[model samples]
Target chain A: MVEIIVCFKHVVDESELKVDRANNKINFEGAKTKISDDDKNAIEEAVRLKEKNGGTVIGLCLGKADARKSVKEALAMGCDKARLLSDPAFQDGDAIRTAYVLSQAIKRIGKYDIIITATGTTDVYSGIVGPALAEFLEIPQATFVSKVALAGDKVTLDRLMEEGVETVECDLPLLIAVAREINQPRFPTLIQIMSAGKKEVVEWKASDLGIEASTVGKNGSLVQVTSTQVPKSARKKILFEGSASESSERLADALLKEGVVN
Target chain B: MRFLVYSEDIDVELELVSAALKSQGSQVSIALVGDEDPKENSKTLSVAGVSSIFQIQDPALKDFLAEPVTSALEQISLEAKPDFVLIGATKRGKEVAPKLAVRLKLGCITDAQNLRFEDGHATADRVVWGGNATSTVSSKSGAVITIAPKANERAAGSSQPDVRVLNFETKTRSSKVVGKKAKDSAEVDIKNAQAVVSAGRGFKKKEDLILLNDLAGILHAAIGASRPLTSDLGWMPESRQVGLSGSTVKPKLYVAVGISGQIQHLTGMRDSKLIVAINNDKNAPIFQECDYGVVGDLYQVVPALTKALRAKTGR
Candidate 1:
């Protein structure tokens, strides 16, 4: 049977992300942590595919030890096994280092056919991990995948490409990053929750993983934090507070002046 | 000097980026993350003067899904350190970049069209409110910065660097991906095309597209549309849209049939080799920027244009 691993993260909730000017650090106090919305989709996709293919679904989470609470949710979601690599040292981990740590664990786990992930995370929504991880694994990758089904030796997928849907066929042991459109994420049933409670969650650390500090967290990261702000979009709404005919006429005129409606 | 770097990596695309720290006299190492084949893509990037290729190749790295991608990117950033990171200013990139910045204690510059290195740090130039005001922002935090990826040409030549593998561990949380469906479209991709014919909300109805297709067929160009033309009336998928919240196009020849070139929309196709605007209004914003403008009703002008093209090419 194939082994499929889904990497998940517990980050500061979006509504609570704030910048502390005094220290230039993110205030994590009282900040509720939850699995990233995009990561949830990744976990769910892995669970669904595992169920269909009869493969093992393993969940890997990185962050503080407190993140285990979030890891439990992955177990409840249908992951057969869950592993948490939480350490005080890995708390402020960056992407490149995170990839290295996770890749080593996957190699230790051994024997996998397919891996899936969500399009992006609510925090650090760089949307680069899917391709980066695929490159790390040295496998052919397909991004923006919305639909997937196992067809004999290859996985048939519908890629949410630019204009039209791409019906792609790739061999197994491949990487596919899923968009929100790819699957309707499923909630773990109560029975699954009870079973998950009994399931084991393995733990690892920076030293336990045999990683160097220069390549793990802050020092290992290639990019740094610049600034954060709400997307300030100024909408000069030409509110046509008139009848539809008047609005349509004004819109048409706007189009004509803008050269749209000729 | 300040360098506006573009990296699709999740973790490191922040505001307080300091690439100059590594190389005393070079631009910040930021550019689009292309294919992950190190020997092929990395060699190409090396020739372009990029210091490193922050590659994330987890087994799950295929699609550009937002959430998990954000999570994994956090992993990559923790590994390969760069000055500033930029993502494509598409829908997913816009949503993901700002959110990702927050996780890594970073900031973001939205919808940046161009990037340059300045002073002793990197400052990004982005339009504040759409196209109303252009602002140049500098970050003392030296945090990883995220900007909309520009149509940056790939640096010619190549260098092969060590391909570092990153594997991050995480908990499996419950979220369901139960169904999958694709937004259907019948048009060609505006980015990869050589020439394009686009429409805007001015077309009025679906039936008006016949004239557009005829003209496009004669010109040997594919069809595209502004955001409203496809989103409001559902004439096409969001992917075919050319404007803010859509794909950026730098085609050779772009024909605007019924489009009133709003700045948000114009930014997507502004780099076209030649722009032809067809609008009844001679003073339309599109006319100002277009290489050629025809002031006439599309009902008559379209057929005439098609006939002229057909006669000239004898197709």
Candidate 2:
């Protein structure tokens, strides 16, 4: 039987984020949180793999304690067990520190066949954690994976790249960072949501995972965010209100005058 | 400052070289991995700002697999000890940088832009929250960062860099490429296109995209689409998708037809020099972000615009 670990992120709902253009800052207060879109795809893929093969799917998350609510959602969708790596020391970790923490937790678990992750989180979109985790754990990784076919311990993956797709093969004990096109995430039934609370959920801290304080959190971050600002551009906001043909002619003339048209 | 730059594509490598050169008194080195002739590759890479070229000639690296490339680069970094490792942020580069960073225990940044050196530290800006805001980050210790493709100017100078070949072990490779399927050649390269006409869900049907095609054909522009047309409706290939998840375009002129202008879509094309939107709803968010907006049906506006442009330009 295969043992799968699906890693997901709890991030600010960027769609609902409010940018104060006047101040050139983002207002994060009162913002909501959810499982990132592509991470949900990772969770769905893990659940599907478990259903296909005789195996168990364990949900893993690294977030604040508030993330437990979202972690329950993973259980509702189908993780047999879950682990939440939440500690005050883990705050403000960059991709490197985050990957290190996850790798340590995986080592503590001591048994896993495949680790699934999103190509990148919707919030940061850095796309570093998966490959970094693979390095920290010393496993092979296939990123941007759109398809997966598992047979015994061998896994075939179709990786989507800018030019095309590459079909690859690797053994288990691998890391696969899935793309959005992999599969559609399913909604949990009401019963499933209710019963999800009964599943095993463990909250582990840095001390529990044997992670030294110097190796995580803002203190250990290699890259520091020195500043942040909203990218501002003043659009002309000119409106051409008329019949389609009239507006079309006017737009063509205006574009030609602007010299943007060749 | 010392910088190590590597990319699978020669052109992007040159751009990274140029970016590194932007910092005065900087020494740039490139690690080239492949079975190809290092002398031939170094001829193109040895620019004015570059100090040396490190070549790891191996057959296993010919296919652009991350495992082997990372291993080779790791080998070079151990010897070079450069303060900054700049990798081309292609699909392969993204995979390679993180693993390399973990191997070296260095911090890593992705999609780094506006790189500058300060007090022996490398600092750069990157887009976050899907282009809503920019974050300026810095790393005092050595770091691995992926440079977005075409993010910087190409390096130009008469100086030549010394080339050193090293033998690297590829025993770490755990996956193998069995086959590859190239995408259709018909798909336009929107990233390189000077003008683009993007479609959105406002189209009634798939065949109706002909209107957008006609407009783009006359303008000599590429065809781009919002995520729905490519990912959900299957009207176009994913390459034609212009959004946070798809290709980002900064063409001189961008025409959005029936697009509602979600932030995800806006993040990709907001950098275009001039933007125009045609939608039936005046309140569509696309109008807020466009330089010029027309409140009318795209079916009528698109064809009429095409006809007007065809007549005006005499194309």
Candidate 3:
């Protein structure tokens, strides 16, 4: 049996973010939050592995209390149980601090054969936490994994890279960061959704894990975000609505005139 | 300031070298990690501005796995004590930066677009919020940062730099490379294509993609897919997928067919020189990001556009 752990995040949907060009601000107020798109693949892969190898899939997340709603969906999608870290001390953490907190939480979980994470998150998209956590745990990691096949205590993975794919083999007690190409995340059926409430959801505060407050959150972070701005789009945004043939002809003519086509 | 840089790719290293040079009076050292002789790579990488090149070689570092690479970089970092550890933001760099930072008990900033030094601190601007916003991040202490791909011009230097070879005791490698497959040359490569015809969920069926292929063939464009067409429907291979998780392309001309222009998709191709979108909904967000937009069904617009291009070229 492979004891699989999948790490995920609750992030505000970036697509819903409204950019304020005049003020150079992003209005994230009331933006909808969900289990980040990439993390869903991690969760799904965990469930699939558990189904094949016969073990438990545990979803681990660190976020604000509001993230619990998203964590429940992880359970619905086949996490046998979940661990939520919603301590105030864990808020506003950089990747290093975030990984520290996650590593500590994973320590509390104790036993796990495999740890899974997405290539990156939707909001921060730093692509850091998984490898950092693996470092903290002193484990090997295969990032950008497209395929995984477990045999006994060894797992073979197809690691996607810019130039090509490399087949990798790692022993048990390894971390794998999956890409979107790895698997199609399943949408939970209504029955699963209804029953998820009955499943175990254990929330942990920073104190619960015996982590120092000074080493966890904003105060503990070495990097500080100074400012953010949305770049103004330079596109001309020319639009043509007409009969299909006419619109097509106009677009083709424009392409030629623009000198993008020979 | 002293800066240390390493990358799996030499081109990205040049970009890091350029970024490091931006800090006035900055001394940049490059770390070459491989089992092969570093003399050739060191010479190729020794731009005039670089102060030194460290050739780090060990049997355990034979492969590009994160564990050994992080361990090797960690050892080099502690010994060199650079003010900034700049890694090229390739797929491997993303994994290694954080691991190295945690090992050094430092913060890590990933995919930094620009790096500047002032008032005894380093600040980096990065695209965050899924490329919807850019955030300027800084560190109170020295940090590890991965430079975004192509973020700076390749460094051009004309000085001979000293090269130092360092060998570490072979550490136990946890992962092994069993096989490798280079991207099939016959596979359609949209990353380097001048033009791309991208499909989206609006594509009704797998066979309907023929319309895009026809259009792409006429325009000498490669085929790309929105996340749905590739991830959900599996209509196309993952390589052809273009989005946050897929290839980030800056083609000269990008024609998005039926893609709704989600922020994730836009981030991948918004930098294209020219963008065209076709969709039935006028209010589709893709319209805002496109240089030219047609508010009509892709089923109709794609075939008609193919016909129009075919007629114009008379091929």
Candidate 3 clashing pairs, residues 3+ apart or interchain: B48-B157, B48-B159
TM-score of chain A of each: 0.81, 0.96, 0.92
Residue ranges of candidate 2 with Cα displaced over 4 Å: A234-239, B188-192, B281-289
- For candidate 3, lDDT tens digit of each residue in B190-264? 888988889998988898788777888888899889888877788888788787777888889999999888867
Report the C-alpha lDDT of model 2 over B76-123, residue by residue, as the tens digit. Answer: 998788888999988889899988888887778888887777787778
User: What's candidate 1's DockQ score?
Assistant: 0.03
Candidate with the greatest TM-score versus the true structure: 2
lDDT of 3 at A251: 94
Number of colliding residue pairs in each model:
119, 0, 2
If scored against the real structure, what TM-score would every candidate get? 0.52, 0.95, 0.93
Docking class of 1: incorrect
Query: Can you write out model 1's per-residue Cα lDDT over A1-262, one digit (the tens) per residue?
Result: 5578888878777545443535534455797778886688788888888777787988888778788888898999988888888766664455545666776666666777777766666555445555445545655556677678886667777765544466666777777777665555677788987788888899987677777766666665544344433332232223332333333344334433544223
- lDDT tens digits by residue: candidate 1, B1-315: 333344444222332133233335654443323224434443444543445555545434344444455666666566655345555554446445544565565544454434455443445555432232344555433444444433443344344434454553432221223234454443345566777889887687887887788877755677888877765577766667786435677776788877877665776887776677777665556765676556666666667666555554467
Taking all chains together, the TM-score of candidate 3 against the true structure is 0.93
| Model 3: residue A180 alpha-carbon error in angstroms | 1.9
Q: Is candidate 2 or candidate 3 better by DockQ?
A: 2
- Summing lDDT over every window of 10 consecutive residues in candidate 3 chain B, give the lowest-scoring window: B181-190
**Residue-wise C-alpha lDDT for candidate 3, range A139-248, written one tens digit per residue:** 88899999999999999999988778999999999999998889879999999999999999999998888899998788999998888888666789999998999999
